[model samples]
Target: MTRPDPADLHPWIAGYLTPYTGRTRQNATQYLRRWETWCGQRGTSIEDATRTDIEAWRAHLSARGVRARGIGAALSPVRGLYLWAAQSYLITHDPAHLVRMPRRPTRSQRPWLDRHQLRRLLDYVDHAGDPAMRAAVHLWSLCGLRPAEPRQLLISDLGTYEGRMSIGLSYRKAGGADRLTVSPPVEAAIRAAVAGRGRGPVLYNENTGTALSKAIARLRLIRILDAARVPHVTPYGLRAGFITLSLEAGVPERDVMYAAGHSSSAQTAYYDRMRHTIRARAVHELTDWLDLTGTPGVTPMSDVPATLPP
Candidate 1:
């Protein structure tokens, strides 16, 4: 079916997406427009959309081989719309209020460098990498930044938070910003990259005074890894390296979760390869309350007077 103009169907889309940032707003607009096209086909206005109409639309998307995650992403805006409409007094009933997003399929643990391999990669970059590449690598590998983060960071994002060196990032997976404490290596790399400049891209060319393109950053990393004789994984692997290695080095998982900007422990665990390997049983914790001393002060369950107490 030909796509219809989203605005003709829903004039409120622009206002609804204002809270989202960057590509998020763009993607949400796209999702809602597709939904509007679907609504046009069924001759149902969004204001008059019923729960059954939403479910049928979900089924339609599913029939076309859209995965659960894609379906969920497409539907997210509709849920937001009803809430917005109800609060704005545009609709009395929320058709999407009870509609549940499809559960995402379980993700396999992603690739990451082990400590020794990562050290070698870092060493190579430090010795031969251009200033921009070195800083990007350190931010991703040491500070657990997303691939886009090191590329997009500004010099002003660096600051002192609670007496610790902090890197403030505005581009996060969930939206908003995060201020992560930096490791010494990350601090040194960032300082060197942004030296003598008050406010500009953190990863910029010395001669050009312009930010390094994503291609340049990625290409350099691949070459550096190859020269260092390390397994070549995508830039995301560098962040996974940070999380996996941090947990292995005895940094608490909860702390890693916060630093990595994960919404839940499960998201952090998905990036982990070391910690979940079972060294001890969780069932062992059940025995923590056990008094195995056989002291007479603790009555045996067989001799308990439960009936009398009642």
Candidate 2:
């Protein structure tokens, strides 16, 4: 049987999701559809779903072995739709307004690589055969670009303002042009990666000559970590580490938030922890580490095969 158009059942859905991307639109539609089906089974319409009805749906998801995170993801669209409808005067109240989703685990609760592990990973990437892969690591670790952000980056995105180098993100997480001040290493890596090309992706597959997909980029990072003997971490975890390190180094909270593409300082603060000792102590203090380049167990770039493997 054909599924009825969600917008047909509720015309507001179309306009509500119109601003979102195709993938997001599809996911939101699916989530709303699930809610619609559940409402019908419960002898109610989405417009009439009470707070109790939403709670029951949550309970239903829990009974089906859906974890808290999964349940929250599925319910997000439902809440969004109701909230939008209420604001638009299509509904008298938002049943999902007071209803709460399960709390996500705190940043400190999740596993992330430490400074030593990150240095090791970078060293491994530097010695890897792919220049694009090495550049990707630098962008993530140094500039804190999201996995997809660097993939969409073009040569034109490289910029300088007030004599400081920066990378302009066209597809920022917040849906606007976000320019991040690049560190020396980040600037060098990006400049070298796009040296010959006037325009195109900063990282691309040599064989395909196309931008690397998120999955492929993630696989490359995993391989680098394995080679470096670092514990497995998600791409997001690398971003978390960047925020954590920057804050620990006494970088202003606003600067860290902007660099990490976080919408709020609170989002950046989640990664801050008292137990994680500062890596760049000299950055916060006047004293300098005698040899910051010499990470334990990793040789200097001069000793490693820095060039792309033949």
Candidate 3:
């Protein structure tokens, strides 16, 4: 039998999810559909699903060996729907509010590659002749970009600010434009990857001529790590190392946060153990090791502004 239309059951879901953007909106849509399916299978309507009903569903999922993270992922959207409905005055009482997620198991801190290991990865990509791969390595391994950050970039995002190449980015989470002044190697690699395309993802597959996927990128990185005898690390590990190493090297906490795309100091503070990590130099001090090939943060050309220092 086909599932019933969710709009027929409740008309508020669309309005409730309207504020979410990108992958967040997609995931919410999927989770709500699953909730609707579960309600239909149990002969209950979403409008009438009580806290008890949600608890029962959680119990059922747990019985089937679903992990806490998986269960939480399924429940959050449903809970959000109820909260929205109540706030909008569409529902007099909110259900699913009291249903708590099962506690997740704690995992150890993620490991990261040192500068030497990262250099090896960079060297590997340099010889690979895939401009997209080269740009990806530079952004993530050197610039400390989260995996999603570079994946969402468009070719148009790369441009010159004050005679130096820079990337203009709008954060998906924070929703602000963060323009990063790049070093010579970063500028060169990004331009080569863009390859005169007016628009498209920054990380593209030359072989397939499509946007490079995060999974494929991770798989490629893992292969390099294995060959180089480096420990496996997630994209977050690369970011962690960037933050940790920069802080240890005495790059000011403020500059470190700015470079890492962190909106607040609290976010940057979580990466290191020290309360204070300021030193004599600015951001360029930390990035100078990259061999910027010009005075750090100095404009090669005249007549433009630096949005944020390198």
Model 3: weakest 10-residue lDDT segment is 273-282
Query: How many steric clashes between backbone atoms does each model show?
Result: 0, 0, 0
Please give each candidate's TM-score: 0.72, 0.77, 0.73
Candidate 2 achieves a global lDDT of 0.77
Candidate 3 on 27-61: residue-level lDDT in tens? 77777877878888888978788888898888888
Report clash pairs, candidate 1.
Answer: none
What would the per-residue lDDT of candidate 1 be over residues 123-179, giving only the tens digit for each residue?
888878477888988988888888888878988888897787888887788567888
lDDT of 3: 0.76
Q: Could you tell me which residue pairs clash in candidate 3?
A: none
What is each predicted model's overall lDDT from 0 to 1?
Answer: 0.81, 0.77, 0.76
Order of models, best TM-score first: 2, 3, 1
Q: Over the stretch 184-257, how does candidate 2's per-residue lDDT look in tens digits?
A: 76777777677688888888677788888888988887788888899888766777778777776778989888
